[model samples]
Target: MSFSLFRASVRRAATAPRAQLRSQLRIPLRKFSTPPPEAPVPTPKSNTTLYVGIGAVVAAAGVAFYSFSDSGSNAVKTGVQAAKVKANFVPTKEDYQKVYSRIAGIFDDAGDYDDGSYAPIILRLAWHSSGTYDKESKTGGSNYATMRFAPESQHGANAGLNVARDLMENIKKEFSWISYGDLWTLGGVAAVQEMNGPKIPWRPGRVDGVQTQATPDGRLPDASQGSDHLRKIFGRMGFNDQEIVALSGGHAVGRCHSNRSGFDGPWTFSPTTMTNDFFKLLFDEKWVWKKWNGPKQLEDKGTQSLMMLPTDYVLVQDKIFKKHARAYADDEALFFKDFAASCAKLFELGVPTEQWVSPEPWIMKNVDEK
Candidate 1:
């Protein structure tokens, strides 16, 4: 306890191994503890364990620095970005509504296109894409969006649909996650709703399929064909007489082009709007063979400007078909109801039931709907 003794004790403590001093102080040693000199220095065998412990601590410190430090943040951010890339994208109804809004915005942007609205042709694209479904083979239809490929795109019935496909491609770019099948079918739904037509219930589930899945040509109805052909084409699609008459009312909007279907002219006076007019005009008009070089289409003797395809005329000529057509022509509300139901079925033709995002299809709201 004397000054000289205390000085000697302090010198010994300082000179002794720091581990021994720490033990005297009752301090706990961690995993990488240093032994007192009298315990014998660690051998090369033990040095391996000591070096591994030091390396592990250094590695843990480096990870913490990378996670928290500004300079190391870029690496951390890159890892997060990679994780995001790997995660699957699932779109909600709101997401699909944004896509619908974009499609609706473009419908009226057509400068000189038919009726000054892209709605008709866009609807046609949707129809032709889905109409290819043959229930027997279970091939084609909107499920694959095979119209994006060859052979099918060049099918006679699909002529001029390129305009619609190209227009929808812009939408696909904005919503890169949406499948082409969903995009084209949704495009059809948008066209109908925007043109003051019936609401088509829709949901997204179609995935793109390979080109080899495309249906054979002539699956779509030939405009020049008569009632039996109509029965055959639509009947193959699983439609009964009433569904056939209702679906044909889609002609109430779009026209036949000589350059496209080899028949030219609009089915109704208002080609831009959806109405019972197609059925009405078919009954009201005096349709005679057109005096044209292109094909055997009928022009109304009254106007000469408006025309009808043989297929359109047959809805009135065939007795069974005439009954349904008469009902649609007499009652606009009935036409709207039938068309909405049939078109919804048409759009969803080849899509598997399991692929549907919901058990019940969503009624996508129109742009004007609050």
Candidate 2:
């Protein structure tokens, strides 16, 4: 008989009801065995047939034991165990969208937080986690999500990020299967989209790494530094002048905390919404040094309520950076397009192309769309 037919027979016998199996077992063991008087000398073809028959018999016997040896419940339990082994959980885009929805729901839950929204800090967490990338050494970046460990988490640039981390921990508990790198970056994407920013195309594949993989300190930018420092830092991550200017537009939403960065105040009037107002205010008004005991930062002369970091001020001071900044200030649509592209690149740093689940990034819909 063909092997396929033999296997099909075995499957039918294994799945038979317990009473049927008992009756079949009683039919006769001698019927399946070769008669001693008529048995031929062993040959390759005969041996192969004998082995296949033996295997089928053994398989059917094991299945019968599991199915009827104890109770009907045992048979169901065995089937479940086999099914579990055959089905492994793989998250799809819809699963990721559910995660995105959860994050967006919690953005404004904290009444005491800056601007009454967790969106800024969540975006910062994604930024700092990814900003650690070193193109030459391939040491840092979002691939590992190493900020959960020490040294990197304790880095000066990461101060007050614990709030962001703690906030994400809650989300992690709810979606236990997601890696930290994917979760944090997804949080950033959700924050941007919910705040009316550009639709950042995203995909999932990043895996969690150990403490030994944590990047060294100073990989992130220093807010006190100027244009040269900006170039050296972002350049290390393989970003150009235009990309740097485009990324700086992120300052439009978040404010500095005295307890965190030492320099205090929001970069724009609306510290919660996404807008090109940061660029507009950068050139539209004069910036003067804020007279404070804190670290040196610039304040708008018009209202003095808004603030800009030394790194931010350098964009207008440096000619190349100024050219791009001028363009963004003139065109909000262009700023959104560039920001989405560059930020998507930043979030995907250190992740291998093969690890991505999708050929193209997914543009997750905003919560309002749902």
The 10 consecutive residues of candidate 1 with the worst lDDT sum are 1-10
Per-residue lDDT of candidate 2, residues 1-370 (tens digit): 0000000001111133323533544521110111112222233222333333323332343355355433354344334433322233344566677788878888767565565567878888888889889999987888768898787888878887788899888877676656678899999898787767999999876756656678988778887888888889899999999999998888877677776667676776565668898899999989999999998888988778767788888889999999999999999999999999999999999987655666678899887674
Clashes of 2: 0
What are the runs in model 1 whose C-alpha is more than 4 Å off? 1-86
Q: What's the lDDT for all of these models?
A: 0.69, 0.71
**Candidate 1 residue-wise lDDT, 1-370, digit = tens:** 0000000001111123435634654533322111211211223222233333323332343344345443344334323322322342235666677788888888766655654567777787888888889999898788868787778888767777778888988877666556678888998898888767888889776755555577888788877778888788888889888998898888776666656566665666666667788889888989899887987878889868767777778788889989999999899999999999999999899987656666678899887676
Q: Could you list the CA RMSD of all candidates, in the order they appear? A: 31.2, 23.7
Decoy 2 TM-score against native: 0.77
Candidate 1 overall Cα lDDT vs. reference? 0.69
Per-candidate TM-score against the hidden true structure: 0.77, 0.77
